[model samples]
Target: MNATQFKQALTHVNLLDIRTPREWDDFNLGGFHVSLDTLLERIDEISKEKNWVIICYNGTQSLIAMRLLKAKGFTHIDHLEGGLEAYLSL
Candidate 1:
């Protein structure tokens, strides 16, 4: 989803941030954080029931995370098209 769509759906979807720990600490939109590097290692911890919206510094990593989650049988998944950078820009 794009930033606008994400904002519209914010209250309904689960936010899954997949950035580095440092990046998350520096600034974040507030969500369940799981760095991209450790995503696979901690995949099992994420719930499949919720509608998840994956986010990263840019759209790149979140796209990867969405794929990983889909592979793990997560049916409801979306990602910010341009990430927080784009959202903040708005």
Candidate 2:
């Protein structure tokens, strides 16, 4: 999605940033914060119904994170289509 679409989605969904700790310290915006490693371990603990929007430095890792969440039966999962770095560019 483009920036406008992403912003609209985040208005209704929980936006997540699943980057490395170091990467996040450099820059992060949004509430849901889970490193990729941690998310892998706690995927099942997240609420299945809450709208979850996974993000990473780029979109690649978020896709992986999204897949992991989906494997846990999270039906309301979403992702920042272009991730945070892309958001910054916008």
Candidate 3:
């Protein structure tokens, strides 16, 4: 979703930050950190009961990650429309 929609619904969804460790250490907007590279291996760590919002540097990676999660049977997966860059700008 776009930043406005994301912010409006943030409180109700599960957030997954899929940025690299270095990127995560640079700054975080809360939620769990699981780099996209290792996401598949750690898929079980995520909860299926809640909607998930994936996050990344520029939204490109997170969009890919969202597709992966959907293919893995996650029904409610979405990525930040423009990732942190856009979100921060908002």
Model 1 worst lDDT run, 10 consecutive residues: 5-14
RMSD of each: 0.8, 1.6, 0.8
What RMSD value applies to candidate 3? 0.8
In order, the Cα lDDT scores of the candidates are 0.91, 0.78, 0.92
**Consecutive 10-residue window with the lowest summed lDDT within model 3:** 5-14
Model 3 lDDT at residue 60 = 96
Q: Which model scores highest in lDDT?
A: 3
List runs of model 1 lying over 4 Å from the truth.
Answer: none
Q: Is candidate 1 or candidate 2 better by TM-score?
A: 1
Expressed as tens digits, the lDDT of each residue in 1-90 for candidate 1 is: 999998888888889999999999999878799999899999888899888999997799999999988988999899999999988888
Clashes of each: 0, 0, 0
lDDT of 1: 0.91
Relative to the true structure, candidate 3 reaches a TM of 0.95
Per-prediction TM-score, please? 0.95, 0.84, 0.95
Model 1 residue pairs with clashes? none
Model 3 CA deviation exceeding 4 Å by range = none
